[model samples]
Target: MGVTGIGGLFFRADDPEALKAWYAQYLGVAPDGWTPWEQQAGPTIFEPFARSSDYFPAERQHMINFRVTGLDAMLERFRTAGIEVVTKAEWDSPEIGRFARIHDPEGNPIELWEPA
Candidate 1:
């Protein structure tokens, strides 16, 4: 057989429950421990950022990028839910579409990208 799409993204969380709730509430991501969210069907982009990349400016070491649809609507949802969404002018490119940043309860940086 051939390789399939991404199955899951796992990471350490100081409070898994709270973190899961944050994702589910603000990002509309389902909470399934160790199980991948069956993301809405669409195009996906996967790439690694260089260590020197300033895309995510947290003191931590890693960031996760979530490919998403309806970027504007989602950003509004996060704001209505009292979550702060960060945007940068440089992060937007004519070829790459728009991007917004948010953090989980445990301070994990999440990049939400809407593809071009």
Candidate 2:
């Protein structure tokens, strides 16, 4: 027996409260306080990025990808909320899925994925 699944993700934020609020407001994460969010299971990718990879910003140590249902709807929501959503044609395919990128208020890279 090995690891079951990801327990949680911990990171440092300049203003934890404000960051938490941003995540709650936009991503629908931690909407009901510090309780656990029940996620609908599917595919999860756990790949490490090369140091020289340009997939994400150079300054950030890591980028997180979250599975989503509706890519277009989410993109529209992000646009309506005044958040910049970055998408590229090369990042998507019929076999894998679609992806969009957005940064948190504190400049953390967040990737949204919608599986094909």
Candidate 3:
């Protein structure tokens, strides 16, 4: 059979355990290899941005995007938890979705998409 979906993401972190815990507590991801996170049926975008693109930080080579349901409420919770969330009006559209940006402790960029 052909590829079904994304299996897992492997990346380097300063403190793997701490990063894993951060994702687990903040983003509610199961970083443990034994427990796989379930995702709904939806579209998965796999476009590559230009090298000089300013969509995210230039120092970082890659960024991860996560699809969300309630953008406003989730952002509010993130704010209450003292996590910084960046949103721009231009990043939202009636056809596409709302978006917010956040960086990990190591300055890796992450984009949150609440699709329309």
Which candidate achieves the best TM-score against the true structure? 2
lDDT of each: 0.80, 0.89, 0.88
Alpha-carbon runs more than 4 Å astray in model 1: 34-36, 41-43
The sequence of per-residue lDDT tens digits that candidate 2 reaches over residues 1-116 is 99878878889999999998999888888777569988887877788889899989989998989998888998999999899999999999999999899999999999999899
Q: Compared with the true structure, what per-residue lDDT tens digits does model 3 show for residues 26-99?
A: 78877574588887889888889999999999888899899988889989988998889999999999999999
Model 2 / residue 105 / CA error / Å: 0.5
Q: Give the Å error, residue 113, model 2.
A: 0.4
Candidate 2 or 3, higher lDDT?
Answer: 2
**Superposition error at 71 for model 2 (Å):** 1.4
What's the distance in Å from true for residue 79, model 2?
Answer: 0.9
Tens-digit lDDT track for model 1 on 40-108?
A: 776766667777787677477778888888999988988887778999888999998899998887778
Residue 80 miss distance in model 1 (angstroms):
2.5
The 10 consecutive residues of candidate 1 with the worst lDDT sum are 30-39
- By summed lDDT, the worst window of 10 consecutive residues in model 2 runs over 30-39
